[model samples]
Target: MKKILYLFLIFLHFSCADAQTFDGSWKGEVNVSGQKLLLVFNLKKDSNANWVGTFESPMQTSLKFPINTIKTHEDSISMDVKAIGLSYTGYLDRDKDVMKGVMKQGNFESAMILVRSENEQSGLSRKQDVFPPYDYIEQDVSFQNAKGNASLAGTLTYPKGGGSFSAVILVNGSGQQNRDSEVFGHRPFKVLADHLSKNGFAVLRYDDRGIGGSKGEVNLATTIDFASDANAAVDFLSKQQMVKTGKIGIIGHSEGALIAEIVAAENDKVNYIALLSGPVLKGDSLLILQSYALGKVAGLSEPALEANKLNNRKLYDILLRDEPPKVLAESLEKELIRQNNGNALTSDMKVKLSPMLIPWFKTFLRIDPAYYLKQVKVPVFASFGGKDIQVPANENIYALQRLHLNTTDVTIKDYPNLNHLFQNAQTGKIEEYFENQESFNEQLMDDLTKWLKLKTK
Candidate 1:
C-alpha cells in the first residue's frame, strides 16, 4: 500500500560457456496479481572494466535503469537499485547458470530465481496512457514552498487560450513521487492532468519536495509540512494569469488525500476536494488494518500474521510515548529483536519495519482524519476502490458517510475491481499496479470531470 515495490529486482542466471562471469542477458519472472511479468537485466563491463548492469521490464517504457552498488566475488553478486531503497544479494550455482537470491526494498524481501535467457522481450502494452498529441497546453513549471525551504517543479497543463479557467492541484500520496505519480511506467497524474485540461480545466501536478527537479529534504517532513507545499501551490495558481482566483481545488491520492484534507480544512482557498483511496481510520487503526489486509493477500499464516499485528501495535504505542527519538528507536530495536525471536522476521521484514521509528511515521500514528474532516466545509468528493487493500473501501466509505452525514455537498462512490491506483484490476494486489497498462480509469475520469464541472460552474 505504501508504494510497495517502486522498483522490483530479480536476480537471474548468467549463462556463458564460462559460468564464472555474470556478463550476459538474464531473465526472471516477477509474480504479481497472479500474473508472471518477465524482467530482464543486462550486465556488462564498461570501458573502465567495472561491471555495470541495466534493468528492463516488459511492462515499463524505460528499457534500462542502471543498477548501482554492484559487488561481485567469483560466484556471488550483490547490487542496489539506483535512487531507491532497494538491494539484491544472490549466489550463483557452480554447476548451473541459475542464481538464487532475495530482493530487499525497505523492509520487504522476496525470494527470486534468475534464469539464463538469450533474448529480452517487451510484451506488455499500455492501452490506456495518453501519449502526446497535445489537446491542451502543457509546460514545465516550478514553484516554492518557502516554509519548507523547498523548490518544487512539475508540469502545468491547461486548455489553450484559457481565460481565467477553473484549476485543480494534484497531490501525490506517500513516498517520493515525481509529478506523474509514476509507478511501473503508468503515470496517473499525467493522464489525469491531460484529461482535465482537455475538458477545459487547468491542472498542476508537481514533484514532491527533494525529488526530481524539486529541492528539499523529505526525511524530516510530516503530512502537515506537505500541506504547506499545497498551500504554496494555491498561491502560485492565484498568480497565474490564466487561472481564476478563488476557484482552485485539490485532487489528492492516498496519503495526499490526507494532506489535502488538512489544507482544505485550514485554508479557505481550496474550494473543492477529491480524496482518492484516502484512509478514513485514525492513523494507528489505519496502519493496523493495512498490515492485516496486505498480509492476508500475501497468504501469511494466521499465527505469524497475528504476531506481526501485535508487534506493530506495541511499536505504534511506543512511538506515542514522551521520549526522545533515539530512546524510541532503541526501544523499537529491542522490541524488534524480541519479536524476531519470539517469531521470525525475515531480513526483508526488518526493511519494512524500520520506518516506524521515523518522525513522519510517528506523526502519522498520532493524527486522525476525522479531526480534519469535521473542520472542512468545502464540497468534498471521495472515491475508493472496492478491492483496495491499502485503504479498504468499505471502511473509508462508511466513515466518510458518517462524518459527512450532516455536511452538505459531500459525495462518496466506490468503484468495483479498481485497485489503489484506480486501475481496473484483478485481485487488486500491489504488483498489479505494474502489470496493468491503464493509467487512470476512464470511468473515474468521467466521474471526476463531471463533478468538477458542476462544482466550478
Candidate 2:
C-alpha cells in the first residue's frame, strides 16, 4: 500500500538530460509489475542553456510537473529524482528521439522507454469515470473539524431534483489523499460518489488534513485524529437541508474503515456504515500478514520470510513496551543488524523505518478493531476483495462475520476476483491496479447502491 501511496509522489518528481541531446519531448512506458504506464518528458534549454524540463503522464494524471537534476554524457542519460528516492538511467538513440532506460525506486526496478511524442492525449481508458455536464449537483465545499483545528475541503454531489436524500461520507485510506482518493491515475472515490449520487444518495468526499484544500498538520495526526474529522463531517452533513440526521452514514476504505468504526461506535447520528478493504486485525498483526503476503509475491524464500516475520513480531512487542524512542530505535537497529547478518540498514532505510516509532503507528499497532466493532449498534456492511493482498479478504471477512456485534444489522460481501479497489482483476497484485483503467467495479456499485437504498428506506 505504501508503494501505491508513493507511486504518484515519485511520478511528481521528474528530471531531464543535457540540453543538446535531450532538448525535446521524450515519451516512455514504465512496466510496473505487470502494468504499463506512459511517461513523457519535455525538455528545453533555458536562456542560460541549462536544461529545464516538465513531466507528464496522460495515463496517470493530467498535471504536469517541473523537474530538475537532468544529466547526459554521450549516449547515456540520467536523472535523479531524490524527492522520492528514484533514479532513471537511460540510453538515447542516435537520432535523439528515443531514450530507453530502467527506473529504480527503492529496491524495485522497472523498464522504461522514452520516445519523442508531442500529440499524445491522456491514454487512460476509464469507462466508468464521469465527466462534466453531470445530471447531479456538484459543489466544492469546506467544513471545520473544530477539535482538530482543521478545515477540510471536498466535493458534495447529490441528485439535482432531490427530496431529503440519504447521504454517505467517503473516507479515504492511509497517506495524504485528496477528495477523490486519487491513485495510479484513477480516482476511485470520485467514480463511487458519482454512482451513489446518481442512485439518489448524496455523497461527500474530502481531502485528508494538510493535503490539497484541507488545512492541518497531517504528519502530526493519527487515526484517532482522523476520526474526529469524519465525525465533524457527519455533524456538518446532518445540518444540511437536504440530509436527514439519522440517514447519514460513512463509507470508509482501508485505514478509513478503522476510523469509521471509531466514529460509528461513538456517534449515535450514524445510521449505517460500510467498510471497503477494511482491516480486521491489530496493526502489528496486519503488518506481519501483509509483509508475508506481499513478500511471497515478490519471490521471497519461505525461510527468509519466516525469519523476517519473527523479527518483526519481536520488534512490535518492543514497541508496545515502555521504552524511550532512542532506546527503541537503537534496539531496532540491533535487530535489523541481526536479521541481516550484521549488514546494517542504509541511512535511508533507517529514516523510512522511523514511522514505526511514530505516535500514529504505535497507536495503530495497539488497536483492536473487534473492540470498536462490538460497541457499534448501527447497520454495517463490510466488503472485501478476494485477491486483495493488502487486506486479505478471507481473514477480514471472517473476522467481521465473527464479531460479537450489537449492531442493528451486519452484512458481509466477498468479491472473489476483485482487488482492494474492487476492480475485476487478474492477480489482485498492487501493480495490476494501475494497469486496469476501470475505476470501480460495476457489480460493487450496484451492490452498494442497492444496499444503501434498502437500509436507508
Best by TM-score: 2
For each candidate, what is the lDDT? 0.75, 0.75
| Superposition TM-score, candidate 2 onto the true structure | 0.78
For all candidates, the clash counts are 6, 3
lDDT of 2 by residue, 184-267 (tens): 557789999988988899999998886678888665677899999999999988988888668999999988898899999999
Pairs in steric clash, model 2: 27-114, 27-115, 28-113
Give the lowest summed-lDDT range of ten residues in model 2.
6-15
Q: What tens-digit string does per-residue lDDT give for candidate 1 at 290-383? A: 7766666755568756866787788778888989978887787677667555554445444544456666777888889999989888989999
Please state the error at residue 222 of candidate 1 in Å.
1.5
